[model samples]
Target: MTTALWLLLYGGALAWLAPPVLRRMTSQGISPQLGVAAWLATVAATLLAWLAALLMVIGATTDSVLKGNVVTLCLELFGFSEHTPIAGRVGSIALIGVATLTAGLVALRIGRCLSRLRARSHDHARAARIIGKPTAHPDVVVVEADRPAAYCVVGRPNAIIVTSAAIESLDQTQLKAVLAHENAHIAGRHHHILMVLRALAATLPRIPLFATARHSVADLLEMCADDTAARRVGTRPLLAGLSALAGHPAVPDGLAAAGTAVVARAERLVTPTRWYVQWAHRICLTSVITGMLTTPALIQVLCHH
Candidate 1:
């Protein structure tokens, strides 16, 4: 009975958690910082769920080994003589089996996603090569696209591709700023992190938390890039670069372009407000903390059986 209950709890948690993470990853046009934060949250939540499941498995195994003894011990400890019903025992076992299967499936899905992503990365690198000269740095690449497009193509040989158009679009200072931002994405390996979170969400689509995390991380990643660019080149030139690129038709989806969030980024740059950005930052932090705090409670609930 305890085993079954443990399984149900863990299985339910996994079922609940998976969807949100997946949704977050697939959602459109999320900023970098928000995306990162959301992904981090999803990871934290998934880890906690995994840990809880592990503990439940341990508990179930122990209970199976000492079924009769455990029931007797429980009776003695609680001064009760009621034996668990046969149906309850069977149900518990079923729950345990289901939970184990769910976890296994999730793990398998994540592995498959990683493998696919690796292949995709190779393909992206090949495509990037078609465009122009490859840079020595693992993250940044100078491409020869006709239009000014500053974007990061994330994969195994994750490359930050910037076009000659981009070079000509902005002054030398703005170009430096643009490169700095792209470099930050590469240096931070932001794409890999986003991919993992997205995979987690795909594996478990029922978890709203994962969705929230994905969107938040996407937005945050952009913000982080913006921050990096702002630091390298003053906010004014960065703003100019962003404005110049905002309406460019060449910018593609899934690539971090110079004009990705031009208006919002510009607004933030011009009227810099710690209150606004920090508010978003706090939302990400709060979500993480809430997940962390709830984990112990979740574990305790599992242990009660």
Candidate 2:
């Protein structure tokens, strides 16, 4: 019981404390890929900690109930009587009930968010396929819109949609660069990661961490895709292409070329990376994630013994 309480407190503390630390670390121009990994790791570790605590509480309650019932039955057989500790029983029941209810609500919220996202993606993809013209690139589709826009859709048929105006505005190299950027989003499965984060944020709007993480990680993922596109096409062309498309509208169900943190991403692309500093940041984040996940279990084990 003592172990369970400690685990619960530790989990809650880590959940509250991890976000700011992660934000600070990631803001220092660490590798955006590493930033995404760190953020995901923090969320995963927090969930693991809470799950461990809930399981511990459930296990302790089950053990107490079985022991109390067995002892009472044995005493009654000998013409004696014993009562279970009402306080402990009630407390255990309350904790278990609260945990169950919270878990159920979270699950339901995630399910709803996922369904809505998938439905929207499907609807948009179908519309794009119907309205957009096919291009030399089998996966690329050209839509007849005056606005200079490019975005990727992940659905029944994963696609890169570029507007007619974007085609007219960009040179070949710039167009290729922009196409590469959208391709990076598709290749990296960034949509799936965003979906998970969005679902969690929707589920826990009150918890600032989830909502903040959703937005922060979205920007980081864009940086990650930026790096990939830059690697494919020289950074200059990519920057020019992105600049042309900057401030273009974004689709809620798709990842747009200039949709997220355009100025910051441009600055990051121009700034040179310090491999040594990035390595150090990676090591620190890895250590923190490992500690967050293992500390609660270690405490429970120590208390048990």
Candidate 3:
């Protein structure tokens, strides 16, 4: 197959097909970190494949400008029968402009998002301190609020907030679970993880790849924390805490917890990943990651076709 068709297979079709499979793997009760890695691998592969295709398109256009015959060659290669000289030349030039414009816009958007997230993180850390007070837990702070609220603000002196309602509502074991859960957030460095992915997503909000990546990573991070907390304090403690905090407010941007996945986390803890499912996740992800790492080299070699 020509490079264009190969690009479509890897970049266009495979990108859309892979996300669901990754999501399914996450639900298999396998290793959450591995699931997160697979999600990252999938998105990186899709982005790299699309980027390779874009470079190829631009290179072809450049070739047409200097080499003269590249336009006619590509038109015939792709079976474009409306292959007038004027049409071929115009198409290549137009593609060059479009690719340039797209790259510029994506760069600008990513820069703006990173700037905003930095500012927000600063403000969020400040506000969390004002609302909460120092507790025995060096990392955690408790605030007096009637409504239930629990969230963490990232960076040094990270805030893991617990509301009056949360403290009053939960038993000693459940409260320990909450602390363990928030502590897991700090240890896992989920805030930094999500922030980086969010920056990438901001660059290409129109693409499903970014959205799927952000969600999948965030969810897996939460699961990883849950696993840690469970092993430390037992699953029942985290499970009860999550149940009581079901209707609580959402965490600040860049923070993750058992907030959204209360039911899912509970269910997962009840069941275990079968050996077959674990092996399947490993096998499939290894295959995709290998393909992702190698495909660009192969595509580059065949690009002249």
Candidate 4:
């Protein structure tokens, strides 16, 4: 039990330190899609490490109080060796306190985020129906706004919204590119990704990785959508559309920023690196997926060792 407790703690600490490093490593690799996968894997692995530690804390503490010793229960539950020491009461209690605090914070953060998203979604739908008219494209609605802005209304039966200023500002091909990019955002379900990262960051702002992960994931998701749109509508049109929309403010409670992430996306389009995918990037992505999926088995093997 003692070994398991320390192992879980060390695992979580190691996971907590990993996101920024993985962000750098995957950024040097291939697609933004690959980077997104790595970031999601880091989040999954970190959750597993922390949750395992919290459960071990509760299990050991409860068993020690009820059965007068926890080693037997720990051995049966976690497959720790017979020689493994019983968990000390003091450490178990401390871990339980920490776990309880973390869980409470996480719950509160999630509740607040869900409330905000629901309200924003409702407001967006109302605006779309009232001020925006359905377009010939069927999936798009043209909002009669004076600013060169575009963003998707994220919810079930997602809708893409374009301002009248956007229509007056862009040509046919640029409009297609804009629609394609917004569609990519909806098709990729990028808002949900941001919501999870935002919730984690809200709950654990002191953690370096969560802060970095929130920003990094937001950028990667935009890149992924840019890649998708570029492939469909051609990079030149996409780049042109992005350039045209620069300085226009993004919609409130939105996933993509019109001006903020455009420079990097434009540079990526101009560079033309679609054919630069390498075996190294594929291996890294696969390894992250494997590590996250195999964590439980690896923990068991470590206990046996």
The digit string of per-residue lDDT tens for model 3 on 189-219 reads 7777788689988776767767787878887
* Top TM-score hit: 2
lDDT of 1 by residue, 1-305 (tens): 34334444554564466446444442332334544544565457556655565665546544754573232212322356665433235555665677678778778998998767656766776677667676655566677667777877665556667777776788977767777777777777777776776776677666665555655566567678778888877787777777766777533324464544566666656766566665675575566547644765665565464
Which stretches in model 3 have alpha-carbon errors above 4 Å? 1-5, 63-94, 199-203, 252-256, 301-305
Ten residues in sequence with the least summed lDDT for candidate 4? 69-78
lDDT of each: 0.61, 0.79, 0.73, 0.72
Question: What does candidate 3 score in Cα RMSD to the true structure?
Answer: 3.6
Model 2: lDDT equals 0.79
Give the TM-score of each candidate: 0.71, 0.88, 0.81, 0.84
Candidate 3, residue 211: Cα displacement in angstroms equals 2.7
Q: What clash pairs does model 3 have?
A: none
Residue 25 of model 4 has an lDDT of 70
Off by over 4 Å in 4: 3-7, 14-16, 70-102, 257-259, 274-277, 292-296
Q: Give candidates' CA RMSD values in order.
A: 5.9, 6.1, 3.6, 4.1
